[model samples]
Target: MRNTVLDMTRLATMDAEHANRLLHQVRAAILAGRRPPVAPRPVIDASWQRMLRLGFDPDGRTSSELLQPDELEHRRRATVIGEVMRTLSGGLTEIADASLQIMVVTDPQGRVLWREGNAGVMRRANGICLEEGAAWTEDTTGTNAIGTALAARRPVQVHSAEHFVHTLHNWTCAAAPVHDPRDGRLLGIVDVSGPASSFHPATLALVNSVARLAEAELRERHRRTVERLRSVAAPILCRLTGRALAVDPHGWTAAVTGMAPVDRLPLPKTFGAGRVWLPSLGMCTVEPLPGGWLVSPEESGPPEAANRVVLDLSRPRRWTVAVSGAAGSWTQELSPRHAELLYVLAKYPQGRSAAELAADVFGDPTRTVTVRAEMSRVRRYLAGVLAHRPYRFSEEVRVEVLRPSHPSDLLPHSSAPAVVGERQMPGQDVSAERRRS
Candidate 1:
């Protein structure tokens, strides 16, 4: 059956007209409750099944809804993907312009954040509601490159009849997901789209390359920001006492005293100077520094028994970890890095070394420094329930991971090598929910 599907893909790629005819036949067979003469590619077949399950009609007219001006502006400002849009757009501008293609960047939610390229193509796109601020998730707009790439967590190309919506059958698109390098979170997707005739196999590779470049740029920018904060924190750290650390606005550590360096500290969503009980750091006084916050530990309290840690990664966007023990319960919204770190820790109760964690999170075992720093910060809030040497949760604590119902949705934003490998693990039901005690 798999070989049959591969043969169909080869036939479709070799002859577009035949592909269209086969698609039409498949549609007819589906309507008649019969199988088509030739099977469609597996990806396309899976998309059709998803559309059917969602009660979407293949011939139904779906309207592309655009976000209001203010809403669009807010999305642009909040998305870090905007920082790399110019670079991605610039690289593809000439090719897209010449080929009458439009380049689009969308947030992880599939909301178009930016659109550029051929003027004529842009005008045509407006007709289909593909302009800025439009939503294009598979659930909303059927199976297109932007949405499918996100759903599959990989690059994808959709041509003509592969689109579930009849109105979109004349177009082709290639898209790749762009992830935040700090923590493998999906920032958005970059897509090149045009008429079906413009479909080229190379387009998928091109978009994938551009996506890589965008991630690299994001990483470099973060590195520079950390460097700046470190410079500002050096003199301040000199005067600090006890186990203290200076961290940037997002909790990336700049410097430390009396303790090993950490990758990031879990600051509250609304951060400011005051006395707060941090999970790993215990009770501490947080003071505002030049470029970051200075946290000074005040006490090391008694340990709590029968603690519970819940790592929630079920939603499309937000992720959080909830910790409850004798100190009381506190929930912190996780940054991508923290989420990945904790997820890995939850998967391995026995504990993982810095090198192992580095390999799991960043696909580089040599990045022990980065792993150690991240673990150091993680230890702050979870100090009582977490142990070092080999980082692991305390045996006394019960851990529950709230995973997405669908494996594809499990950390939908994460593209870390380890996370990706876990997503592909067999035997897990698409609808199974397990609570590990």
Candidate 2:
């Protein structure tokens, strides 16, 4: 739902009378040589154009007017922000001498939602006014962390020269955009800032990881609410169904009008990994079982089903084959970088050292870290391959091992070559519960 109450309250607070007076004072200060309109002149950029297209409508609303104290109080924005601040602090504190000092969150519309950081960094960022309720659209604030992120919907790193604000030229920031799971909607942004000289490549990853963590929490909040509602409504449907459960998509459930004992209930999969949805009565998942489908409420259930059967075999013409590389050669199915990395790992039983692997592969010492990071990513890719098992690699002796899990061990005798599609990527097909970030 839209934040109607907060929006209405903000509009009332930023009334014309107050705005006119504030503008007059600003003009007077400029005339008296007490302040300048801004430190440097602003210029248009691609980020600005994007924000405008995204409905980041800017008017003359001040901080107080844009965010009402009452709404802030009711929503406990401070408390939530405080928790986010703590999470960020924990995420950054472990890095050795990490210069990251500030972090902030902003709504999808480019309004500052929350901010927290060290005193020194806050003082430095004050000129940009990154406090709660301030606008952070690229056009208004220039190419800063919050603005550029919302504009691009991707993680970005902006150094001193990239900052549009002249006074903010000494700082660098990295930010990532978070999305809502239900429809993959852009929700907010999370950003980290530090001195411009702190340009470690990992800085971007740190910011993205923080944003991902925050986005996870938000998704969990929504999932819990939906789960609770599902819990309450499930049993009621079970009692009425006479059949005890029903499973379908979200739209199917919405079409049913009056309550019936055997009403067709739609069960949109709660967690996307395993293909199943449970609707009504017991909250059990209506999953494909040995012969047909069965509903089970327990988290742990009988295994050996297919990966979501979207096709109905009774209707033969709907048969589809998801193609990748040819059989017995899964390595060939991956991208060039992924294919080479996996091939090397497959041959080395004891794995390899970072230096040894880099020399053999990329032939550059500086590329060692880069290769190691990609190996870390290969582990994530292996998750879908082995029922989400962790892939291990030693940095000291860089050998990738899958530890011979059940799924991985069983893969040798599997019917045919498995084609895990792009959906296997994190956040691609998981249901709302697992869609955190």
> What is the Cα-based lDDT of residue 160 in candidate 2?
53
- Candidate models: Cα lDDT each: 0.78, 0.44
Q: Return the top candidate by lDDT.
A: 1
Residue 43 accuracy (lDDT) in model 1? 60
RMSD of every candidate to native, in Å, equals: 5.2, 19.6
Q: Give candidate 2 misplaced runs (Cα > 4 Å).
A: 1-45, 48-86, 93-100, 218-227, 241-437
Q: Which ten residues in a row have the lowest lDDT in candidate 2?
A: 309-318
On residues 84-191, what C-alpha lDDT tens digit does candidate 2 reach at each position?
Answer: 555554675444234646666666666666666666766766655666666776657666666666644567766553454445556667778766543344566777
Residues 169-281 of candidate 1: C-alpha lDDT, one tens digit per residue: 88889999898876566789999999887878788888899889989898889889889888988887888666788887777888899987767776656567987666666
Clashing pairs in 1: 262-373, 263-373, 263-374, 279-380, 279-381, 280-380, 280-381, 280-382, 281-380
